[model samples]
Each structure stands twice: as C-alpha cells, then as structure tokens.
Target: MTPSSALKAESPSALETISRNPRIRIRRSGPPAEDAKCVVYWMQRAERAVDNPALDVAIDVANELDLPIVVFFSAISNFPSANLRHYVFLNQGLRDIEADLAERGISFIVRRPPKNSLEALLTELRAAMVIGDENPCREPERWRSVLAHRLKIPYWTVDADVLVPSGLFPKHYFALHIFRPKLYAHFPTYLVKPENPKPVRQWQRPPNFESFDVKEDLTEGWKHLDRTVQPVDYLTGGTHAALKRLKDFVANDLAHYQDRRNHPEKAGTSHLSPYLHFGHIGPLTIALAVDQALKQKVITKEAYDAFIGEVIGWRELAVNFVKYVPAYDSIDCAEPWAQKTLREHARDKRDPVYTLEQLEKAETYDELWNASQMQMVKFGWMHNYMRMYWAKKILEWSQSPAIAFENAVYLNDRYELDGRDPNGYAGIAWAIAGVHDRPWFDRPIFGTIRYMSAASTGKKFNSKLYIRNVMENEPPPLLT
Candidate 1:
C-alpha cells in the first residue's frame, strides 16, 4: 500500500506524519529474506505507546504485512556522562512504558547492552525491519547511523518527538524571530488530533526478558558517585505521572500561565519539561489538551495561543535547529560575528570566579543564584525564567566560556529530570554560546551575547520573595 493511502485510511488526524518508504530499514547484519515477517519498533525516545507517531506508523505497517510487531528497548548499563539522577528518571519512565505496552498486548523486552555495545544486541534481535525515533543528539544519531548500515533490511526514522518533523527545516535558526513564522505555517497540520492505537486481534508475545529494577539500580548506582552530592526529588518520573501533571496544568495553571510564568514563586509554568524530554508524554498530547481547553473557553484565546507558541513554535524551533546543524552543540556553530566578538573578549576578567564544584553545591555569593541552584538541587528542576538566569550566571562566574558551558551542561544533565535532552543542549548553547541569540552589548566573558544578572531579575520581580519561597519549600536532595 502507498504511504499516502495508508495515512488516508487511518483517522484524519494532523498529529501523524506518514513514511513514504515501501520497506522500513533494519540495521542488523543479515541478507534480506524474501518472507521475513517482523516489524521491530524502536522504543527508546518515544516511550509512551499512545500519542506516538512512530509507534502508530509501525503498527500500521505491521498490520498491513500481517506480521506481529515487537517493541525493542536497549538500556545501556552506563550511558556516557549519565549520572545517578539521569539514570533514575529514565529508568522510571521505562518501567511505565513497559506496563502501558503490556496492557495493549504488545510484547516489550529490555536488554542492558554492555557499555558501548548496542550493535551486539541489534544483531541478536535480528529484526526484519527497524523503525527508530529521530533525535538530533550525538548518541542517538550515532546509534541510528550505525544500525542503518549494519542491518540489511530497510530502516526508517520517524519524527515523533517534535510538533513538526526536523527534516522540514534546512539550517539552524538565529532566534525565535527566524523560526516562528516557519512553525506557524505548519502548526495547523501538526496540531491535529491523534488516532488511538487499534487493538491486536491475535497476540504474539516475544520471549520474556527480565525488566530492570529502576529503584534498585538507582540505589546501587548512587554508591559509585561522590557521596557529597544529592539526587533531585522534584517529581517522580513515568508516563502516568506525566499525564497527571499535564491534566492538572490544563485545568488549573494554564489560565494563569501568561501572568505568572515569569514569577518564580508561582506554580504557573507547567512543570512538564522533564516528562516531555523523556518522551513520557508527547507534545501532541499537550497540544490537543490545550486546543480542547481553548474550544471549551476554559482558557482565553491569548493564553491558548501563548501556550501553543511555546509548545509548537519555540520547542519545535529548537528541534529543527539542532536537526539541521550537526555541530549545534559546539560554540563554533554560533554566527561568525558572534564568534569573533566572543573570542576577542575570551580573557576578560570575571568578578568572582567559581569552580564547577562550588556552583554544584549552591555555594555562590549571590543569594538569587544560590536559590536557583538550591531549587535544582532540592527539586530536580528549576523554573523556566530562573533557568535562563541560572545558565547566564554560569557564563559570568566561571573561569572560561568553555568551562562554563561544560559545567552548566553537566550540572543540568546530572540534576534536572529534563536534562540531557535536545532542548537541554539547545538551552545551554543559547545561554553560553549564543546559538539562537543575536549579539547584544559587549561584556567580559560573555562578549556580545546577551547578559543576564540577578540585579536585572530583582528589577523585574521581587527577588527576596523568590528566594524566600524556595528556602521555605526546599526538599532534601536525593541521598547518595
């Protein structure tokens, strides 16, 4: 069946994008068998079964072939640069996905690939066709490319994580101004309702594999890390938790989102970044809920539009930028003019240099910076506006631009539930290297990149109130 015809046959939802390839590619090594009858769905990025475009597409192809669909999840014992906090959050999400798939009669198997050995497991699975979630990050992309070459059968990647497929954009954008119009053009088609997964008539289960115990692994793993640092206790990780948070945000917080989003004291911003980063809850689900609220007149048009602008516009904008620019994580990817200015001011003396260790401990002199760090330490997440200030302060306080970038990325990835995401990388790049930002007033260390300071935050909002709130509610960090 033609891809277009297949899409038309399904629900007329704008949430899904169809694959044009006749046969999905498999990256495992083997000669193609004419009657090889299995479609293996990659379950790494898009963890949730529902509101997932890749899973939907894989199911469609499997149904057409009259073959059983098997879901594959590879949990490497040690993902590069991942700390205890990162592991705990991801493992929790995986546990939830496993249960969700079991209820749908889809077999789920997780294999702990030895450190740096994903290919070995792919060879063992010998999947006829492989469908993977598309991500622009280094590790996922590297794995995808290696699998594509080794596997003889057709392999395909679906853009399930973003509102618009990353392939739609050509290059990294300078800022929101450049990417907003492009996203707005595609918003109507991307924001359509999603089709529910059709139940399988006959269940065919794969061999049972032991599910990894997230809590146990986390407890054992914490002993290996420095005993001084603590884990974040902001929100529990999982698809179920993510869905509940989204529902609560829509029902209560979204109406006040426009007004209190910038206020660090208010629970106005939807604390769904970590869940979205892990793909526990997809952007489509969030978009659909917001759209419904707008139609029901629960949120004003202005509020709804504001929310959509972030979910579809800015979020996809970052995804598209990373997709097109392979070196987006590097400082060289910044505009030539910005790079020149930054280089010229590379050695400008910082007022008070803070080592990565000091920053991690929330020991900085600035009370506001300390408060934001405490939030990350205690809650595993920081407010959206504070995140901007928090990152910018890292640039201002560190010994060098590169060191500052490394420190910010490491601390965020280690502590925040939403760290190590494409958005996380992009946010860091924007904060330190000016990836999507334009040059502003020249300053030491920052050069021409826009500068943010606690003073500016104080001028904008009640800084004392923000600090007081965090101190009052701060939870003890996760124990080592």
Candidate 2:
C-alpha cells in the first residue's frame, strides 16, 4: 500500500526530518533489528492517540520500515508517588487509547509489571525499533537512561508532552524573561500539531501475545499501592474528557480568564492540569485551542496573553527546570543567590515550626493555608494561587528550609493529581527556594526568597468565599 499524502512531511525524506528534529532523542544508536516483527511505541508519558508526536514517530517509522506498529503502555502499579487516584484516571485514559488506536488500525497492548517491562515486552514482540514519549521527571528519565544502556535495538523518544522540546535549551533558565523570548523564537516552528498519520500496515498481534483486560483493575493486588487518595469525579481522565474541558474553558471562561484566574473563588481557570500531567492531553493541543479562540475573537487579547503566559511561558520554563536542574525537586535546585540567602537565614527563628505530620493534616495556625490543603486533598487539585501561598506557608513554619521542601514535595506528590510533575516540582522550588524567582528584601525564615503572606494572598482573591467554596465542594474527611 502507498503512504497517504498526509503522511508526507515538509521534507521529502520523513526519516531525515524526524531523526534531525530536536524533539526526537535517539536513546540507543543502532539500526532496526534484523528479522524484526514490528515497531513498538512504548507509550508512557504521551498516552493519547491523537496529537502525540511519540506515537506519530512510531507510526512513521513503522511505515518507513513497511511493518505494522503496536502501542505498549506499561500500567505498572509501582510508579513512584502514584496512587489509586492517579491509576484510576490513567486506566480511564487507557480505555480511550485502546478505542482510539483500534480506529487507526493500531494494536494497543496494556501491560503490567514483574514480567512486563518495556524491554521484556519489546523483545517478546520482536520489535524492530522502539519509540517512546519523554518524561523529564527524575525516576522516568533514569529509567530511560538504564534502558539506553540495556536495550539491544534502536530506541527513540519524543518530547511529546511540552509544546517546545526541552532540548532546545541546554540549561535551565533562572527566570521567565530569559526563557520566554527563547520560547517564542521557535513557536512558529514548533507549536503546530503532529501529522498523526496512520500506519500503512495494521498491527497483527502474534499468537500467545498477552495483554491485561482494559477494564480490569490495573492496580489490583499491589499491596504497596496507596489507595487512600481516592479518585475524584469532577475531573475525569481521557483525551475526550480533556478536549471537552478545553472546549468548555474556551467557550465559558476564557474571555474572563485574565480577571478571574487569580481569584480562587471563581471557576475561571482551565482545570486541565491533571490531564496534562497524565499525558491524556498535550500542551500543543491546549495551546492551539486557546490560540484558535483568540484568533476567532472569542477572547480578549489580554486574556489570551495571560493564559498563554502561563501555558507556554511558565509551564515550559518548569519543563526546562526539571530537565536541566539535577536537584530539581529539592532546595539545591535554587539559584546561587537563593541558596546563599537560605543559608544566611538557616538559624532564623520559626516561631511555630510544624512537623510533617502536622502539615499533612492541615493542622496549621493559618486558616487560608488549611483551606488550600483541604482543597488539594479533597479534590485532588488546587488553585494555583493557593498552591504558592500553601508552599510559602510551609517554608515559614517548617523546622528548616530543607525540611519544608521535603515536606512540600511529599505532600504535593502524595495528594495532588498533578504531583510528581515538573510544574509541581518547580512550583515547590519557587515557593521554598526561589528557583524561578528573584530575591526580595531579607525576611525571617524565608530570607531573601519572596514571602507570600497569607493575609495579602487572601486579600488578592475572595479568601472567605474561596474557603467556603472549598468546603462546599465536598465533605472533607479529615478537615473541620
């Protein structure tokens, strides 16, 4: 069968275009395996069937090699800091993946751990080559590094999650001013969606090949898995759900996004962070939607600028942070000034130092902070303005700055649906250690790091109404 016109990229040679693209990182240097069965897409980060450059690359490679392509998603129960809330949403996305892949004539195989690692499954399938999506988080990056050392066949991974590939910037940008110009410089070239071409040959699953039932509980029997973080119904997972949310945001809230995003009491911001974290939705998808809305005069220029500033500017800055900063999740990731200032304030008195347990339980003197914690714990999400205030309060109250960072990370990773993401890590670092922030007048505990007072933060928004809204959302189990 001939390749469709849509499959043909700008360059005559699709292979050259893909291989030379900055987004595609060649993990293993080798040619396709001899007597290869098929091309495998080790879908992990970019889990969606549409607008996923990783899957597109795999399909392109399979078409170029004249072989079918199969998608291999590891529904491992042991993903670090992941829990029942995360898995339930992930599994929902998997259902959409299977359904979507079937329409494209691609075979979707859902696998579990113990015997079903990417290496084991790819080898079992006699894969010619493997393509994967990028995840900048420490554990996942380390997994890729180990696989690069261990895999015999060629492997390539696409930075499918971010609008701009993190590879463009070799090092972390200390501030958004430096990163924003660089981001927009390449936006015209990189912000467009992938071709999403279908494979020339549909994948044929070999005899004896096994996959877990799509409807079965992927987390079942994993005793170590944290089931305490129950799933929330307000924000369901999957590409369909993500797209719906984007549509709703554009239609209903985007026009007023600029005014209301900072106000926690209003439903102004797009609540798509969980979907973005889970890779059910890609940044390109959301950015394009917002851009389209702007062009169509559906939203004001100020609103568009404000929303894009967060999505493309600050969000990609976080991606760059985790990719380049070795100690991204800790106080060490802070700038030199931030580090020095923190050291100077090491002995600063913390009047009401809170233990990790106390912080986790939201038993703090600050009522606004307590409301934010309850919001995160009860709904698996929180308002961004509150997140900053929440982290700053932790720094002000914890035994030490390092302890504050550690406790913040533990809580962020433990409760929030978007925890364990670059944004979360970067947010924590910013709040505690001033990673992407500039130093302010020297202050207690926080030193020169920007201090967010609860009173001022609450004043900026409807603090009372926000607290009431959070409480009214649901009957929180542990909160009064």
On lDDT, the leading prediction is: 2
C-alpha lDDT of all candidate models, in order: 0.72, 0.85
lDDT of 1: 0.72
Count of backbone clashes for each model? 8, 0
Candidate 1, 378-433: lDDT as tens digits: 77788778888999999888877777888888888777777777787788888888
Off by over 4 Å in 2: 1-14, 474-480
Colliding residue pairs in candidate 2: none
Each model's Cα RMSD: 5.2, 4.6
Determine the C-alpha RMSD for candidate 1 after optimal superposition of all C-alphas. 5.2
Candidate 2: worst-modelled 10 consecutive residues by lDDT: 1-10
